[model samples]
Target: MTQNKLEKYARLLVKTGINIQKGQTLVINSPIETAEFARMIAEHAYDVGAREVVMRWSDELSTKMKYLHADDEVFDEFPDWAKEFSLSYSRKGAAFLSISASDPELMKDVDPNRMARQQKVASSALKEYRERMMSNKNTWCIASVPTAAWAKKVFPDVSEDEAVERLWDAIFKAIRVDKENPVAAWEEHKRNLKNSMEFLNNHNLKSLQFRNDLGTDLEVELPEGYLFVGGSEFTPKDSEFPETEFIANMPTEEVFSMPKKTGVNGIVYSSKPLNYRGTLIDQFSLTFKNGEVVDYSAEIGYESLKSLIETDEGSRYLGEVALVPYDSPISKSGVLFYNTLYDENASCHLAIGKAYPVCIKGGENMTSEELEQHGVNESITHVDFMFGTKDLQITGVTHDGEEIVIFKDGNFAY
Candidate 1:
């Protein structure tokens, strides 16, 4: 892409995505390989009159080596400045760009248990950050860059350059860069998702049923007064941030949520494989009863799944519940993007870890003691996996005994 074109896309993110205000801070976390695009973004953000632009770069190999060779104390101690910096971002309200394109197997050689612990620490940091954001109302965004490692994951046999180009094309299309005006395109796109939210809100369903060729027969209850939020919210960053501009779904193959901290039941299967800690869990299935995972099966990576479930008391419970239709932009691409960032957006799925407070009414300030009293589960992890496809069906049951067909064969049925 030309510099001008790159700038145009960056401007799209700054103006429409992050809605960069004249004096707001913009943070770009990019890989070293994508410095070119990152610089373009920084310049574009400045052009939109941003007060400051910060950049962070990470090397996958170095990160892996540190975990493999560093002293155990290193994992226990985060730099005070780093923690302070993260807290400051929430306090001041900055827009963040987290570019993830590394291979899922970047740390495959490391010990699995050690890797899980490292993940626990990272997740704990994020949990604190999320809490701060909710309390302070900060806006942030996460996107990916196509790098050599990421390309290898998509097309193992292809040259890195070829993979990068192909992945870039996919991203451009997914974000709707092919449109005449991508910014205008997203504006219109978000409005459509908002309509779906309205539809769900009006349906007033109590339980959702999903039936698909994958042999899925699952029913999940809806929490009372669950608000449907498409893209956007009132936050301290420019209210116009593209991150906020999105409906909760993206390239969205699914519209989903965590089962009522106490209402998930029945059986469901993963339509696609899940990459957990550099291992693949293929042909996975889980049986739930009254919001708890009772029985589960996987053709691969059972140990990782077990480790995840055993991580905390609430790990066995569901965290995120989502809806992904078959006709999502990623699904329409007709490519099995193995990465969860894209794959999860390509199918309806649920998570097995920490549930989002925002997803439930009166969840944010609710303490763990209070939540447990209410029979809602909480955890430090919130991993999502896909299970719904175009061949699947979802039925919504309302409090009034109305069974509404929300999805048929993977597309929204009005």
Candidate 2:
């Protein structure tokens, strides 16, 4: 990619993605492979009067090695220091920017149970920090950059350099960084998404029925006071930032809300492969009865899928339901990214485990028990899997039992 475009992308992330304010500290969790791009973001953050920019670098290769050779007991424990590191910065009102660009199959050969154990332990340790982010108590954004292995997986026929170039072009277009004014472009995009959110919320939908030729015939119930949110999110009025708005996910195209903990039933199929911590799970189908997965099967990476579902009791239930069109920019690109960050935006998807507290009315201030009382599910994990097809149809049922077509042939019907 050209330096001009890279600089523009970096600036858009700083100014629009997180909307960093003057004198606010910024924390970046990024892969070491993208140090150059991360540094560019830091430079832009400093230019906008940031107080301090903290870097937390990760090496997926090293992590893979550790998973391969580390003791079994190691995965069962989470260090208190690591937990403190996250809590301290989060308490100080730091804005967070995470770069998601790991290789799609780095852990394919490794045992999925080990990674699952470590995930459970770390998530338990960082529950407070995770809750803060989920409730929009802190400003946070997740974006991606091109990595060699990721690029190669997305475009296997091309040389590494050519693959990376192609990936960069696609990323720029998806996030609107290719436009002359990316920030303004995002504003217009936000308005478009807001229209969708408003339409869903105004409908007072009590349930949604999904059907497709893939044999998916599922019904998901929405909580009584659920809310649909898309494009941009705001820190709660009583949060440390107090109504400061930020984009949580760059290149986002879905409007999402929480599903009732025990209000889902029927079967759903996967439309694309799911890359779960570097392991690919493809051709999977899940059968749910009263919001719990009763049976699931995967043609590939069945063990990984099993480990994910068996993580905790809450993992067997649905947490989030998101709507995306099959004709979206990311979907139209015709690339199977193998990355949930991109693939989830290309189709309608659902997440298992922890529900965002902000998805319900007065949720940000609700206690854990109170959230549960309102049918919000809570867990240590949140994994999204895509299940949208071109011919899929969605019907919304109002509280008064009126059926309205929300989606027809995989696009919004309004």
Candidate 3:
């Protein structure tokens, strides 16, 4: 990438992704592959009056090896300092920008059981940070950078250079970096998302039913006081950094809320391969009974799927329900990006574990015990997978027993 374009992307990220407030510290969690880009971002952050910019490097090869070699006991031990390292930032009202560029198949050979165990430990250790991130208590955004391996996964026919550039082009366009004014474009996109959320929230849906010939027959019951949300809003009543509403993801497209913990039923097969902690699970189908995955089968990485479900009791149920049209910009590209950040935006999906409190009305004020009392699902992880397609259909079941088509053949019916 050219220096000028790099500078431009950095400015957009600093301004729109996390919406940095003056004097706020920005912590960037990125891969070494994105070192140059991270430096540019740090410079931009300083230029924008940011108090500090902490850059953290996460190399994929080393991460993969940790899973490859670590024994089961290692998963149970999490450093207290590591927990305090991030929680301290939350205490200081800091902002975060995380970059994801891992290969779609990076953990293909790793032990899923070990990875799942490791995840549980980390999740427990970082509980506070995760809660803050989920509640929008800290300004945070997740952006994507493409690697050669990921590029090839999207375009196998092209040379590594061409593949990288091609994937960059797609990402740039999807993220609005190609727009004449990226920040301005993002403002409008965020507005559209909030509007969509408002519309859905006003619908008073009781339950949602999804169906397709590919064999997705499921219904998600909405919580009584659920509120659909898109983008992110910092409440003056909630935190110190409350001046602006920031978008959590640069290219967010889904209007999502929560699913009542015991309300989901039936089976929904994935329309795209799911990249879970680096492992890919494809050709999988899940059968849920009373919001628990009673049975599941996957042509690939079956053990990984099992490990994921067994991560905790809450992992057996769903935490979120999101809606995205079939004809979305990412879907229209006709290319499977193979990364959840991009792929999840291409279809309607549901997350398993740890529901975002903000997705429910008055949820942010609820204590952990209160949230659980209200049927909120809690666990060490939240994973999303695409299931929406052009042939997919969904009907919203009202409290009155009348059914309305919320999604027909992939587009919003309302």
Stretches of model 2 off by over 4 angstroms after superposition = none
Q: What digit string (tens of lDDT, one per residue) describes model 3 on residues 349-382? A: 9898889998887888789998988888988799
Q: Weakest 10 consecutive residues, lDDT, candidate 2?
A: 236-245
Candidate 2: lDDT of 291? 95
- Residue 375's lDDT within candidate 1 is 52
- lDDT score, candidate 2: 0.94
In terms of TM-score, how similar is model 1 to the real structure?
Answer: 0.90
Worst 10 residues of 1 by lDDT: 241-250
Q: What would the TM-score be for candidate 2 when compared with the true structure?
A: 0.99
Per-residue lDDT of model 2, residues 1-414, tens digit only: 789999999999999999898878999999999999999999999999999999999999999999999998999999998999999999988999999999999999999989999998999999999999999899999999999999999999999999999999999989988999999999999999999999999989999999999999999999999999999999877666678889999989999999999999999999999999999999999999999999999999899999999999999999999999988999999988888999999999999899998889999999999999999999999999999999999999999999999999999998
Give per-model TM-scores: 0.90, 0.99, 0.97
Q: Which residue pairs clash within candidate 3?
A: none
Evaluation by lDDT, superior candidate among 2 and 3: 2
| lDDT, model 3 | 0.86
Better of 1 and 3 by lDDT: 3
Candidate 3: minimum summed lDDT over ten consecutive residues — where? Answer: 231-240
